[model samples]
Target: MTGLIKKYIVYTAVLIGLLVFLHAIGALRPAEQYLSRGLNPLLATIYSWGTNINVAFDEQTGKADLWQQINDLQAETNQLISKNAELKAVEEENAILREYLNFFNDHSYEHILSRVISRGDITNVIGRTESILIDKGSTDGLRIGLAVVDEQGIVVGKVAAVKEASSLVRLVNNQQCKLAAGILGSEATNGITEGELGLTIKMNFIFQEVEIKKDDIVITSGLEETIPRGLVIGKVSDVNKENNELWQSAHLIPLMNTNNLLIVSIIKP
Candidate 1:
């Protein structure tokens, strides 16, 4: 134990002497400015390692903060996209409702609300007819010869056949469907518009001497009880004059997009 004490005391004295010598030479003074110049490379290497450690720690903290901000922004963007989708859906529903209201206001006669069920014919009634099916029938006050219409009262077709809970709508595009149509602004021009395919119609039986132009609005003339007056049929798309025949052939663009039908009204009386 005496020898061990002696060894530790000698080691302590040596460390104090080395520190005193370094201080006398100013090696420990102006530490920041002179450390590199006076410090032994081995000791300087340890100091440089400590400084590098601190710099790396700061850089890691900054990177973490940036990543956190990016995550926050991504979350906000997702929320906005979801909200926009919901708003669009509501807007579409409102537009559809408004169109139906306009039709009811203009015609005060008789009306029945119906929803489109399926397209094409289920029973295949008249082979010459283009038809769609509705979810309302005899149960909903629907009957044959009643006019089917879109939300805007645009002439769709007449209910030609029916079951207990469903009915068939003969589209305006049916080969057998015909309507007496008049040019919106014309007093003397009148013709019969008949359906073709792809929801298009042909305004036939108009004399070559009749004046018609593109984009002219065509409406039902109420000449028959099948369709009401002032219901939109289509717009004049093209006109072909034939010298051989007494009537001119004209193409019509149907007011309704047949494939996209979702809601329709029935003219009861």
Candidate 2:
């Protein structure tokens, strides 16, 4: 133990002598500058690594925020589209109701409003007679032979069959439907109008010299017990006359389209 203590004291004395010699020659200052230069690159590399780590973290956070905003905007756009569709449907329904109300106010006839429910059997014999099923029947005072009119008060069809809560309407273009009609003019020529092959109406038995012309408005003559006068059937599209025949005929086109029927009124006398 005593020998080891002596060796340590000699080593300390030697390091003190060496430091004193290096300081006298200005060697300590040069060594300090060299050491600083060598360590500079290491310190700079550590600082750059720290800065890069921080920037990468910030970029990741920004990307996450941007994605969240895009999702929020997409949800808002879908909600707006659904609301717009609902509003459009409501507007169309209101327009249909308004048209029905106007038809009620324009005429003094007693009528029952009915909706077309379904189409009945289509007999394609001469042409195509389209029959529609309505939501009114004997329960709603609807019966066979009741004149049905469109929203504009133009004659559309007549009730052919009725049930407890439903009725079948034979359209004006049906071959079985016939109306006593007359031209609306000074020399009002009258004739029997019947559906030709369920396509168009033909006014037969008009006197050749009765002064009928094309585009003349035709109306009911009120000769039938069920139909009323002045109900428009159609307009005269063509006047057909044979040179040897004593009578002339007029092809009539219905004012209302039967295929597009939605709501109709049954004229209740």
Candidate 3:
């Protein structure tokens, strides 16, 4: 037991002596300072990396906000374009109404204004005449054989069949349509102006001795009861004369175009 005690004491004394020698040489202070300095540089580098990461995150957030604003502006631009198109359509319709007003004020005939609803022929006693349907009918005091004039007061057609709310008009360019017409030049030469091929007018049955020239204005000769006098029909394009035949002819182009019939006034009987 004594021997064991003596060895334990000897080991303890050596350990104490070694620790005292290390403390007395000033090595402990330098080592402590060295550890602190090395740790400081490592800590500072870690902090700098963390700061850069935070700054990059903030920049990414700002870009996301700016991108959203651009999308919102693009959506607003499309809505404005649709509104502009509707306004332009209204302006065009108003201009057409003004033209109708001017034509009504200048004429003296007992008339009723009507719009062309369709452009197709109806059943007629004179066979099929290329015709248009008007919106006015017997309820509006319209009847069969009423003369239809255009917005320029030029004869375009005559009402052929009348319904309660609509009427069919035989256009002047129809082959079945015949008007008592005359060439108003130095002296009036009256004849029947007939439609040819649904495209032209031909004033036939004129006397060969009559003096007719190109560009002469042809007007109604007032020979028909429903139609009146001085109503312009067409312009003379050329004269066809045959010495043997008693009848002379003149080719005329109608003053009114039936292809774009929009509005017309029926001359009431």
Model 3 stretches with alpha carbons more than 4 Å out: 1-107, 121-129, 185-189
Error of 2 at 45 (Å): 78
Candidates in descending TM-score order: 2, 3, 1
RMSD of each: 35.5, 40.1, 42.3
TM-score of each predicted structure versus truth: 0.54, 0.56, 0.55
Q: Which residue pairs clash in candidate 1?
A: none
lDDT per residue (tens digit) for residues 155-266 in model 2:
7888999765667898877777778877653324389887887788888999877777887777776677887666677878999988799899999987665544667899
* Best model number under TM-score: 2
Among the numbered candidates, top lDDT falls to 2
The CA lDDT at 133 in model 1 is 69
Q: lDDT (0-100) at residue 128 of candidate 2?
A: 52
lDDT of 3 by residue, 1-269 (tens): 99999999998999888778886885565665455445544544554465456545655776966745653563343233222222332343346668776533223568899877665644532333378777777768988877888766677888888765677888887776788876653224378887787778888988888777787777776677887655667778999998999988999877674544567899865
Q: If candidate 2 were superposed on the true structure by all CA atoms, what would the RMSD be?
A: 40.1
| lDDT over C-alpha atoms for residue 35 of model 1 | 39
Task: Report every candidate's CA lDDT.
Answer: 0.67, 0.71, 0.68
